[model samples]
Target: MSGAVTSVFGIEPGDHAYLRYAGDDERRLLRAAHVTAAAGRGERAVFVDAGAWGGHDPRALPGGGQVFVLTPGEAGFAGGRLDVPRLMRVLDAQADEAARLGLRGLRVCVDLDEVLAVTPETAPRGDGGGPGRCPLAVLRGRSRPPAVICHGDRARLPEAILPALAERHPLTLDAATALTRHPLLCVRPVRDPAGLCLEGEIDDSNLGLLARALETAPLDGRDLRLYVRRLRFADVGAVRLLAHAADAMPDGHRLVLHAPGPVIKAVLRHYGWDRRLVLEEGDRG
Candidate 1:
């Protein structure tokens, strides 16, 4: 990871950003980074994850910021269905608590997939139809509302309501995409495909870092795939390094490259490195 601090998606207070992660590990990684960044900025962070189902304890960081986790029951889910208004009020109260705690700002990261799995398809009566009554209304309070990041895993999302889900958010983004340029590369573990996610650019500067990460990556006899849909650039040296990594895999367990961009594809083809790694057209998720 780069030492440079940067926004993963340019998310700001009062902005409701939608994120689609490749798997649970990726979601957890991003969630931790988001919460830590918020705390570093002296903002109270509220995170909603599956672990909260087992009752997560609130944590206080050294930066004078605290984290609160909302449990499943606390989220206003009665009889396996979500109470949107109740959840909204709970979030508002959390923000008020943050204010009282002397936190400068608020940040909330919700595992939307886990919470919405039990949510009803139809909207609750008068929940979102009127002014200041919508579930997201809590995010646009009179004072500063918390910066909100809602995460979903497409594999776990209900196909019946996926379209409606996307329609609700204005700025939807893939978790693989990198919003900053300085990092040059960001690697995340993916569980569904049992591989690694490569974001941003990969060149001579970070080729060694990539090599080291690959060396430490788990390869349990299955082919390791690299998700590179958001990889912006890759030099010939990087291609060569990947080729070597693929060559080193156990027999019948090739390194798979998912959604390589035109630049990487062209480089692989030009140098005949594509023969070393299995190339897939799209992300499995």
Candidate 2:
């Protein structure tokens, strides 16, 4: 529910949150949070591939949000659904930590058991080597789903999430969605006449729109341009937008990108978009 303030995530015992994708990969809503927060908390990086259902390598991410199944000797439960009882155990363990971190209440959660049992290996999250027990440990946070159940009391579970729980794979949103819904800073350019101008930073809040623009929208063979006053060392949000922008562009479209500083230039160089996207002269007027 949009009215809900806090957030919570639930995952299977094997699925963990942090995962390290190659530099240019997108679709990292679940794992990216741990990574950015670790450095802020004076911690190192630890990647966990909570999405890997089949036999595949794990992604690098921060540590924590780890657990194991209750019955190792039991046969499988369902195709996609996790053993709800087992998941509740994992969530209960993390509940104290969640409380300490000052996380919002149950906003979102992911059922890793469903992700592994129901979804085929072909599913994006599942690294389909075979119909095997998911290697990736489960992880739960406040943002999206794939959350740990935290408790076995189904009756005690929030009534709001009942519908989500019924479905095999619940709808999982991300930070970008949160930002799009609620923004800290407003950055909209109003074009009336005379001189044209721009406003706002390529900040995390609006990065959701940028990603949506690139992933879902169609921009083929048309000319696309990003006019910025200046650029700086970008975050996962900014970098992801850039990558999505590049990937989502229509082949016929030529990119006309402009930046005002070397910080942005460094990022451009890192992603090697200079070749793919045409750089415009720095014009900060």
Candidate 3:
């Protein structure tokens, strides 16, 4: 709501780097700001390099010197290929999220043949680069080359993992976006001593709800039991909600996010909850 940019990196929200923290118009504006900021810093260029699964965003900023994204290719039938509708949805989510990060106007580049500029280009004849092929990642900035050479250890990746990327990519990306916009989101579950159970929606809509639940728990006294089954379905919004909730937690109360995170735990991991939200016995406080 405040769209405060939290830090110099603008990595956090309290810094006021964003506007709505979760909207298109606001995201676009903020993204533009980031782009401008990056440019101001004297950075040569910015890139939206796609991952192996071929991440898609609704729009890629065209004004920048150059911008691109990775998409599925027939390289080896890794994930077969996603249909247009599916690709668009993924693209849209990515585009929206990117905008929030201040990289609006991005465009999708379908390169399955590994035709783009990959890092460690030309392979290490003997420098610091690898001798074999290079790996793929969300590369950005400097000169903004056209994906020099697609490289990454795709051998271990299950062929189907590529196809299934769509199934989980959106959720993963959304969770990440939300966390960036609201790093304050974190949790500490308090269980019920009489009956080990925690009831609440792990979604962003109810961050406040989760906070309320945590507030009523007696975490400092006993080990609290928590069920994150309810948190499996949430977006960046929830992260902010969580951030808001965590910022209000009482000292000494512990929260436990009970294993196997819903979305990629890495998405929320960066915020680094660090006992900030303690998980203990049920809400018996």
lDDT tens string, model 2, 1-285? 111221111111122322112221222443444334322221222221233423333322223422222222121234444454554454444444443443311212233333443333322222224443232323333233232221111233344443333332332333333213222323233222111122333455566655544443322236545554522223434654565566656667665455534334444564465566666664442
lDDT of each: 0.64, 0.35, 0.33
lDDT for residue 80 in candidate 3, whole number 0-100: 26
**Stretches of model 2 off by over 4 angstroms after superposition:** 1-198, 212-221, 230-233
Across residues 106-191, which tens digit of lDDT does each residue of candidate 1 receive?
67777666654323354211233321222543566546567777777777776665555556665577766633335468998877
User: What value does the lDDT take at residue 62 in candidate 3?
Assistant: 57
Candidate 3 residues lying further than 4 Å off, grouped into runs, are: 1-201, 217-225, 243-247, 260-264, 278-285
Question: CA lDDT of 117 in candidate 1?
Answer: 37
RMSD of 1: 15.9
Q: What's the candidate order when arranged by decreasing lDDT? A: 1, 2, 3
Q: If scored against the real structure, what TM-score would every candidate get?
A: 0.50, 0.30, 0.31
Sort order, TM-score high to low: 1, 3, 2
User: Which prediction has the highest lDDT against the true structure?
Assistant: 1
lDDT of 2: 0.35
Model 3, span 238-278: residue lDDT tens: 44444455556556433444442323143355346433553
How far residue 31's Cα lies from its native spot in candidate 1, in Å, is 1.2
Better of 1 and 3 by TM-score: 1
Q: Please identify which of the two predictions, 2 or 3, would achieve the higher lDDT against the true structure.
A: 2
